[model samples]
Target: MKFIGYQSLITIVCYLFFIFMSFWCIQDLHLERHLKMHEMQGKLLIVILSIVSGYLLSSFVLSLMDSLRDLIYIFKS
Candidate 1:
């Protein structure tokens, strides 16, 4: 079995954290009185945007790190 790198592990943790935050926001809405429809929709929108942006940023950073690692290996050889 091959070892999974730290970048992958950290990305997964961040994605999970985003999911947890979304749920927490929803729970907060439920706990509050006089819920407004627009307010809920706005919160959902924020969650969706955060997830998409986080995914894009994570992949970009991880790929850049991998390229740098490969370059280091090439120089060392």
Candidate 2:
């Protein structure tokens, strides 16, 4: 995969690592919340928003990289 060059692979790995860490942090935060219903709801919302935003940003970046790679290939050929 042309897009999977050494630097890009490293970046992808780092992105995955960040995703994993975010999930872990979300879980830990939820576990720390008290039994209060309102508190739980707020925390859940924050976690969901964080995850969704991260995913959207990552997808955008990956798509941009793919487009750039295709352009480079076209020029090379």
Candidate 3:
């Protein structure tokens, strides 16, 4: 597959992973009451934004790695 396709797959996987982890943590810590309180106060957007930001951050890191690899290769020649 092309780079774009691979990047998109990675982004989606990362997004899902973040969402899954957040839910797992909330449940594991028995924070249901806190979650309900936040939800009632309309703070769910914070969670959603965090997931999206995590995905974006991963993408940026991946891009940086690619750039660094290219630079290393250039220096190796």
TM-score: which candidate is best?
1
* Evaluation by lDDT, superior candidate among 1 and 2: 2
Backbone clash numbers for all candidates listed = 0, 0, 0
lDDT of all predictions: 0.63, 0.66, 0.63
lDDT tens digits by residue: candidate 3, 1-77: 59889878876786677666655554344343545655434345555555666666666766776798689878788
The weakest ten consecutive residues by lDDT in model 1 span: 27-36
| Candidate number with the higher lDDT (2 or 3) | 2
Model 1 earns a TM-score of 0.59
Task: Assess every candidate by TM-score.
Answer: 0.59, 0.54, 0.46
**What is the full ranking by lDDT, best candidate first?**
2, 1, 3
- How does model 3 fare in lDDT? 0.63
TM-score of 3: 0.46
Expressed as tens digits, the lDDT of each residue in 1-77 for candidate 2 is 67459767766775676566666666665543554457667677657756765666676777787788789877787
Worst 10 residues of 2 by lDDT: 28-37
The regions of model 3 sitting more than 4 angstroms off are: 32-77
Candidate 1 local lDDT, 1-77, one digit each (tens): 23567656776886676556555555454432444456667666656655776666666766776798789887787
